[model samples]
Target: MNPAEPLPRAGYADVRIIAASPDIARRVADVLRRCFDSTEQRSYPAGHDGGTRLQLTVDTAHPAGPARSWLAASQPQRADRPQGSEA
Candidate 1:
């Protein structure tokens, strides 16, 4: 699913990301925070030697319009960073 799209205004949604490394996982979580009104529900080392795992929850019942707007505005700045730089 497109991360930029707004979530439904009902129930709850969960997102899980497994990054190549802990740093990438953290960066992804930060970017997700900018795009959604979500809470960092859990974070832990993945089993089977996988990278860090991050889980986030979005309560669609809550307002998220402002966060979406901010995400749109910040995309340009985020894109300008060097490919491997920290988020």
Candidate 2:
């Protein structure tokens, strides 16, 4: 949740870790276990036959921090100019 901290895990709603860094991976498993019933937490993987996995995955994701700063710089602010200095 914190920018300083990296996201090394994914897919907690489903029973699969998808990808893990092996550092906070055990924490990820704990989160998934809490999200689902304890029984389901014990079973199921990426895709299970006759089972449902929401298939929620991230692809082509970019960090928004730098993008937001870039966009902010492009906006026109009256403070940038003084008394209609230039066009």
Report clashes for each candidate as comma-separated counts. 0, 0
lDDT of 2 by residue, 9-65 (tens): 443222345433333444665553433433322322434333322222222123134
Instruction: Tell me each candidate's TM-score.
Output: 0.52, 0.23
Cand. 1 TM to true fold: 0.52
Span of 10 residues, lowest total lDDT, candidate 1 = 59-68
Could you tell me which residue pairs clash in candidate 2? none
Q: What's model 2's TM-score?
A: 0.23
Clashing pairs in 1: none
Off by over 4 Å in 1: 1-11, 60-87
Off by over 4 Å in 2: 1-14, 39-87
C-alpha lDDT of residue 55 in model 1: 80
True-vs-predicted CA distance for residue 66, candidate 1, Å: 8.8
lDDT of 2 at 5: 50
